[model samples]
Target: MQNEAQYKELKEWRSQHIQAYLTDNKKLNQFHDELMRKVFNKAFQTIKKQSGEPPCAFLWFVVGSAGRREQGVASDQDHGLVYETKSKKYETYFKSLGEELSFGLNEVGYPYCEGNVMSSNKVWRKSLEEWEEQLLEWMDSQSWESMRYLQIFYDARSIVGEEKYITTLKNKVHDFKKGHPTLLRRFLDNMMHVKKAVGPFGQIFVEDNGAHKDSIHIKNAAFMPYVNSVRLLSIKEGIHATSTLGRLSELCLLPGYKELKPYYENFERLLSYRVSLFKASTTYDEVHYLNIKKLSKDEKKEVKHILKNGRKLHEYVQKIIKKGC
Candidate 1:
């Protein structure tokens, strides 16, 4: 099928059925996964019409929330491309595919990443060897930008082509960390501070002004503590899973990380709370904003409890990583 036809089909499906999945996080993400894979495959076919056949095997993968299988009702694109080898001919062919995929996803409703992390960027479209080199460069760099890039890439999951490409790249990161144990501290410093949600007075903070005035930024203030802390622990332990919950599960099995079990429950509740509260969101920003006035007293109390536990989880991971390093 042509790209426009695929886009129309996807848009129709989303408009008619997305509302049903919004209240359930797992189902919603599964919906995104299916839609994205269809786009990926169709984009390839469209590109093939122009470029003939692929010059080499390649992988197109998603990072960020999509990569972790934790997408909201509204999400933007965060993806990259990795082909088997280097050459100007291969580069030209895959670059066209990358641009097609990005445009295709956007036309079908996914927004372009503001950070420009999409596969359409030259930095994110690389040969396998180039990707390895870029990973090493990011790993060795002290700059915050490079570290942020590294962390973003850590969450990548292939949506099309060979999965082993991503697996190999992730293992490279793990091996690098293992050889340079102190790199964990750098990661710790980069990720340790989460936005303060609850105040010393035990009141939750809300935006003082703007479109989301009086609303809490739940994604930053609550979700990141659990997500980033668990991610750090996963890196330190050489756990290769990308999802926060998946990392927590792997952690709970280890002798050193049995204490993480409660935090697992807390994170689970956080996911449920987010999806339940944000089901009405029609924009990406709205998905992260929770207006305090709309929440029931019991719901507010539950949010406070989750925020408190998130802080505790953050501190626990910090202490453990510091002690081990």
Candidate 2:
């Protein structure tokens, strides 16, 4: 795994990160960023050795948790590649490079994406022209599944190669969104399900079946409201920042706002809650499910309070977009 100097340094840093997280949880995100840079470099060296440096310019980007810089101890790979030019030979070169990049990271840690959202997949690897065309097609269709992938693209950040390649795509999305604002309704619609964190009776909605029986899905139930709502706002306002909190920070300055960014405040609290959940977990899978039964009376109250705020923020943002006011 440590075939390179950077990878060896990353291994040492990861060990220190594990120890430091005991005192401060925020350090984990920083470590993930450093780890990804090294991984990208490793991928590059592997490609250079095997393919003799890329024949053309390209960009490599990450999506999902790594894209958001919110990765926990265990995560999977969700990445893509965009080459500067499109050609049969160049595409062939990139297709091989994509496989090398994917497996190279897998060799160290991050498992290949279960959904095939990796560089090895054709859908995630393309030329700049193809990416722009694909984005336009997805936005035009306004389909839930298509829009979902579009949202994932919103989280993309370059790990290797020319970052402007990724920036151009982001700006294209922002530009397309400017003229077609009504798409907000469809975007809002796509975000409207599977976000249940609290019941109508003002209680935590724990799972009743499956392996996670009696546990709450912190990822969807708690985090998605903040993530999805901020994403919709970013799409509407054309903010390019990928993180949910970063999105909220940019939105808070919009011309007229009487309230303190409650959504922002609440999201910060939720991150702390997630850190607590991760600290107590013994396995990677356990990090997603918070055992609400373990929370004290006061902690339970705060959880419900945060849940209620999330629902309110999402509804408020939806109304704002719907009115176009």
Candidate 3:
């Protein structure tokens, strides 16, 4: 009974409803998550159909930024697999399934990590016992690569399978940090070298030449440094906060960190500004000059103040690292 216009309107309404449903529902965040989940479920179903062991035999974790729930719109996959000690026989099959899941997600939109940090990577897909040993080894040796590995592992959050695996991983990380406080200091030092936009003369830092010559490496310069600092602080204080904001909140309770409260507040303001700018740009390109022309005078002033505070926080952390704390 509907005319062509009515039919078109109804179709648009239905699409909007589906999009809203997906956004509101936790299960469907990224196209990759949905695709990977389906692939894993199908792999498990295939095993079940063949009267083989289920894939749920291991715990699956989405690590790094994704694990910390600070993923950008273009986040790549960073995941790990931890199977029970007794399920070692199915390691190859589980790893193969992980690779398949990675491939499927890549096809759906999420790109494969250039660092080879995906679940499909043999380094990440391991049994619980192996993971424990690897973690201990990394903690014992204070190499840059080892520290990076621990940083990723410490930020891990279980996405599927048993919860106890994540609990065990947390315990392991806590123990490692408690035993080797120096590693945390080392991590902080590495993070400080990753600079933000503002330069020494109070000028906005930018590339000198190329297509992205004047653009800011927002992830490397600003966000990653903040994320790493929060992570280092969290590990030192035995705080299990996964997100940067959550870590900042936890830091407020720690002694001698009461001054950090204002910094955290300013950090949120700056983050919001950056996110707004990113949305408006409609591209994942690096931000060059912040368009103060678009903002009111008051808004521009506030942004400048917020950035100044962020720099202060960075310098404070730098001192803490130098002091071996």
* Top-lDDT structure, candidate number: 1
Q: What local lDDT does model 1 show for residue 148?
A: 84
Per-residue lDDT of candidate 1, residues 1-325 (tens digit): 2357668887787889888887777898989988998888778888878889998899989999999888888899999999999999999998898898888889888999999999899999999999999999999999888888888898899888889999899899999997898888888889866888999999999999999888988889888888888888887878888889999999999997888888988888888887887777878887888898888999899889999999999999889889978
Pick by TM-score: which candidate is best?
Answer: 1
Task: Output the better candidate (1/2) by TM-score.
Answer: 1
Against the hidden true structure, what lDDT does model 1 obtain?
Answer: 0.88
**By descending TM-score, how would the candidates be arranged?**
1, 2, 3
Query: Worst 10-residue stretch by lDDT in candidate 1?
Result: 1-10
Q: Which stretches in model 2 have alpha-carbon errors above 4 Å? A: 1-16, 22-26, 257-260, 280-283
- Give TM per candidate: 0.96, 0.90, 0.79
Cα deviation of 198 in candidate 3 (Å)? Answer: 1.2
- What TM-score does model 1 achieve against the real structure? 0.96
Q: Clashes in each model (backbone N, CA, C under 3 Å)?
A: 0, 0, 0
> What are the lDDT figures for the candidates, one per model?
0.88, 0.78, 0.65
